[model samples]
Target: MLGWALTFAVLAIVAGFLGFMSLAGLAATVAKVLFVVFLVLLVASFVIRAVRGQSVL
Candidate 1:
């Protein structure tokens, strides 16, 4: 998930460099959304493990 966010971020940068404003904006939005989702899931996973007395690692 994080990898996908990074991929879209790079794509957005390249598209912006090439002057594809719409595509760049879309990719950047997608990257931001994916990154947020990834973080949320990561934190949830850690919380769940802690609740269950399991090591996060």
Candidate 2:
């Protein structure tokens, strides 16, 4: 998921550089959403592991 976010972020940057405003905006939005989801999942996983008395790492 994080990888996907990074990919979209890069795509947004490239698209913006090429003056594709719509594409860049869409890609940026996707990247932001994916990044938020990734963070949520990561925190949830850590909490679950902690509750289970396991190492989060």
Candidate 3:
């Protein structure tokens, strides 16, 4: 999921550089959403692990 976010972020940057405004905007939006979701999941995972007395690091 995090990888997908990074992939889309790079795609957004490339698209923007190529002057594809609409495609770049869409890719950027997707990247933002996926990144947020990934962060949420990561935090949730850490919280769950902590509750289980496990090391998330």
Candidate 3 residue pairs in clash (backbone atoms < 3 Å):
none
RMSD of each: 0.5, 0.4, 0.6
The stretch of ten residues in a row with the least summed lDDT in candidate 2 is 36-45
The per-prediction tally of clashing pairs is 0, 0, 0
lDDT of 2 by residue, 1-57 (tens): 999999999999999999999999999999999999999999999999999999999
Residue-level lDDT of model 1, residues 1-57, one tens digit each, is: 999999999999999999999999999999999999999999999999999999999
Which lDDT value does model 1 have at 49? 100
Global CA lDDT computed for model 1: 1.00
At residue 3, candidate 1 shows an lDDT of: 100
Shift in Å, residue 10, candidate 3: 0.7
